[model samples]
Target: MKKNIFKIFAALFFIAVIVSCRKEDPLNVDFSKLNIDNPVANTPLDTWLTTTFLNEYNIDVIYRYNRFYHGDDRDVAAVKVDKVQPQMQTVLEGFLLPYRKVAGVTFIKKYAPKQFVLFGSGSYNPDNSYTLATAAAGRNITIYDLNSFDLSDPNTIVNKLRTIHHEFTHILNQIVPMPVDFQLITKSTYLATWTTKSDESAQADGYVTPYASSQPGEDFAETTTSLLVYGQAWYDDRANGSTAAGKIALKAKEASVEQYFTVNLGIDFRALQREIQEVVRNTYNYQQASFPYWLGQNLYKSLIVNAAGDPIYSAFPLSTPFSLVNNNMKTAIAALPYGLTYNFMKLNFTSSTAMDIEINFNQGTRSFISRYAYTMDLDQATGQTKFTIAAVGGNDASWVGNANLLRPAVQPMLDYLSNNTFVADWLPTGVDAVNYNKYGGFYVLGTPANNFYGLLGQ
Candidate 1:
C-alpha cells in the first residue's frame, strides 16, 4: 500500500511539470478585470456604446485578450488586450449613422476590417506608432496597441472614431476611384523640394501646398478628407488664401471632385460633405458655431447656385424641342476667379461624315502667358475620339494665386491639351449628349452633340 501511494504521487508530480512547461501566447495577456463600476455583464459591446453613448451605425466588436504598458524607461510594461470595431462604422457615424440606418447605407469595403486582436502590452511592437486601428488583407484590425491612443490629444481628433475614419478613407478610395483629370491640372512639375520654397512661390506654380503635391493617391485621399471633414468652405478658403497657385490648384480639385461625384456616380458629393461636417460636430459632442457652418454653406453655394425655380438645363434641346443650329455660341468676357474658368469650344462638322473640334484654353492675365490648343476627332465606328489637357503651366489664374503644392498636378491639366487622348463614346451619333470624362491630365472630348445633324440610330 505504501509503495502504491508513492507511485501515484510521482505520477502527479510529472503531470504538474509538463503543464508548467507550456509556451506563452506572445499576443495574449489578460489585464485584471476592468473594475469599471459595473459594466453590465454579458451585454455586447455594441449595445453598450449605443445604449450608453447613442450611436446608430451598426457596431460589431471582437474582444482581444491582450495587455500593453508604457513609460519612457519601458519599466512599467503591462500586457494589453482590446477589440476592433469596423472602420466603416466610424465613417458612417462621423455624421449621420441614424439617417444611414433608415436609408440602408453604402460604403466601399474591398474587405471587412479584421478581427479585434486581444492581447496584452507584450504584443506591442516597439517599431509601431500609436495605431488604434490596422488591417491585413486576410486578417482583422488589431486594436489595443496603445502607443498613441491618447484621450488627451488636444490637437488631434485621434480617438478610435477618427482613427477608423482616416483608415476607412484609405480603404474606400483604394477600391473606388477619383478623377484622372485632377492630375492633368498640374502634371509633372510636382515637387519634392517644396518645403524649400515659400507658400507664395509654390502658389504661383499651382499646388495647394507642398505636401499635397506628393502623389496622386495622396491627393485623392486628402481631397476626400478635406471635403468630408472640413466641408466645402474650408476647401475654398484653402484655395483662396495665401498664393495664386494654391487657389488654382484647389479650384481644379473642387471641380474635379464635383464632376467625379455628380458627373460620375457616388453620394451627392457636395451634400454628403455638409453631412460629414455635421457628423464631426455631433459625434465629438460639439455644435459648430454659426461662422464655421456658414463657411461650409457658402462654400457649397459656390459650387451650385440656389435653385428656387425650374432648372435652366430643363430647357436644353436634349430635353426641350429644338433643332441643329450653328449660329448660337455662349461667350462672355469676365475676369476668371482664382479657380476654374472655361472658354467655349467649337467642333466644326464637315459634310455628313467628318468633324473635328478646335480647342484653346485661356491666355494668361496681366502679362500675356503662353497659349496652346488640343484637337480631337469624331469617330464613325465605335464613336470614340482622343485628346489631351495640359499637365502644367497656365497663368490664366496664375496672377490670382495658386497653391504651389498642387500646381505640378494642376499644370498637367493645362498641358493635357498637348498630350494625346483615346476617347470612348457610350452613346453613338445623332443622340445629343454632352458627355465628359477626365483622363489623368486631360479632359476627353467626345460628345453625342459633336455630329448632331442626324442620329446614328436614324
Candidate 2:
C-alpha cells in the first residue's frame, strides 16, 4: 500500500510540472493596426514600360523613385510621371531607332543598356557641374534633367541625345575596347583636374571637349558622341579652328573611331553618320548646318537641273521652268533673220555680287555667244539674293547689238531674274541630306513652289 501511494504521488508531481510549463498568457496585441495591400496594380505607365521597353528589347525603364538605384549620398529627384512618356519617345526616335537602322535591332538587343533610370532634377555634383548621364557595368544607364525637358526644342533634343549617345558609347567601349591608338593620340594631354581646362584649351590639346580631357575613355566617348550628334560640318569647323597639332590628332582620333565602329562593331560609321544627319536635318530642322550654307566659294560655274523621275521633280521641278524660258528664247531667235538656232543658256556667278548670263546659239554650224552682266544683292544671313541689270552687253560693246537684237526673248528672262528675290537653299525637305551641298539652288523667297534647284558649284 505504501509503494502504490508513492507511485501516485510521483505521477501527480509529473502532471503539475507539465501544467505549469504550458500556462497561456493574455493576448493583448491589436490586429486592426496591421497593414496589407497589393503594391502593384498594373498602372498604364507600368504597362507601357513593360510592353515598350521590357518586352521589346529586354530593357527596364525605372522612372519611379527608388533609393536603391541611385547613389547613397546624392540627392536626385524621381522623374515626373507626366514627363516619362515623352522623354522615352525621344529616346525611341533619337537613340534606339537610329541604332536599329544602322547597327540592326539585333545589335541593340545584344549591346544596348538593359536598364534606364531617369531623374527629374540634374545630378548636381560638388564640382558645380551636373552629371547628364552615366552608365554602369554596360548594363544600366541613368539620365537626369527631365523636369525641364522640352521635346519641341531642337537644342533640348540634341543635348539629351548627346548625353544618351555619350553614355551608350561607354557601354560599347566596355563590350569591345576602343582602339589602343585612340588613347595614345592624346596620351600626354589628359588631366586629372580636367575642370580647370576650358573647352578651347581642350581643343588646343586635341580633346573634343573639356570633359574629354579627363581620361582616354571619356575622350573616346566624347569624340564618338560629338561626331554622331553634331554631324561632319561641326567637326570640320572644330578641326579648322584648332591648333595644327590638334587638327592632326582630332583627325586621327576621328579615323580611329570610324575604324573601331567598322572593324570591331561591324557598323558602317559613314552610313550611320548620314543616317543621324538625316534625322537632324529633316526631323529637327537643323538646316543651317547643311553643306551648302558653309561653302566658302560663292561661284556656281554650272547649273544642272533635276531631270524627270528625280526625287523632287514631281513637286518642285526646275527642268520644266527652265525649258519654258529656253524655248521662248529659241522661238524669238528663230524669228530673227540671222538663221541662228537656239543652243543653250548659262547662269554664271562670277563673283559674290556679279553674275553673267551667257546666251549660246549656232549660226551655220558655227557657235556664237552673247554675255549680259548683272549685279547681285545676296543677303546670306537671310538666304535671299536679288538680281539687277548692270549692263546689257556686259564689257563688250559688240555684244550690245546681239543683246538688243534678241530684246524680246532676253527681256523676259532678264525681268524674271531682276524682279524676284530668290532664297538660296539646299532643298532641305526634297533631296537627300547627303546631297545638300553637292546640289542646291534658289527659290522665290515667299514662294517655295516657284523654286529651282541645280548643282552647287565652286
Top of the candidates by lDDT: 2
lDDT of 1 by residue, 1-458 (tens): 99999999999999999988978777663443555323244556546645422333333444432223122443322222222223324434663353242223454222334233422233333543233445444334444444333333312342444344445445544555667898777777666544465656655555544545656655555565665565444555566663566567777877886677566554566555545544554454332212223222222111111111213223322211111111111121122343333333332222232322322234354222222333434343333445433233344533223324223333443333234343332212221212111000111344233321111110
* Model 1 misplaced regions, further than 4 Å: 1-92, 95-103, 106-163, 189-211, 263-265, 282-289, 292-458
Q: Per-residue lDDT tens digits of candidate 2, residues 1-458?
A: 99999999999999999998896998897553552212254678788888988998999988877778777888988777788888887778778888899889889988999999999998888888888889999989999989888878877887788898899999999999989999999899899788899989999888889999999999999999889888776776677779999999999999999999999999988777767777776787664445434432353455544343256555545645555765677788888888987665666777767776767777899877776778877775557778888855344632686666667667777777778888776653545444544566677778876766655544
Q: What local lDDT does model 2 show for residue 142?
A: 92
Q: How high a TM-score does candidate 2 get? A: 0.69
Q: Which candidate is the best by TM-score?
A: 2
RMSD of each: 19.8, 9.7
lDDT of each: 0.40, 0.77
In model 2, the number of clashes is 0
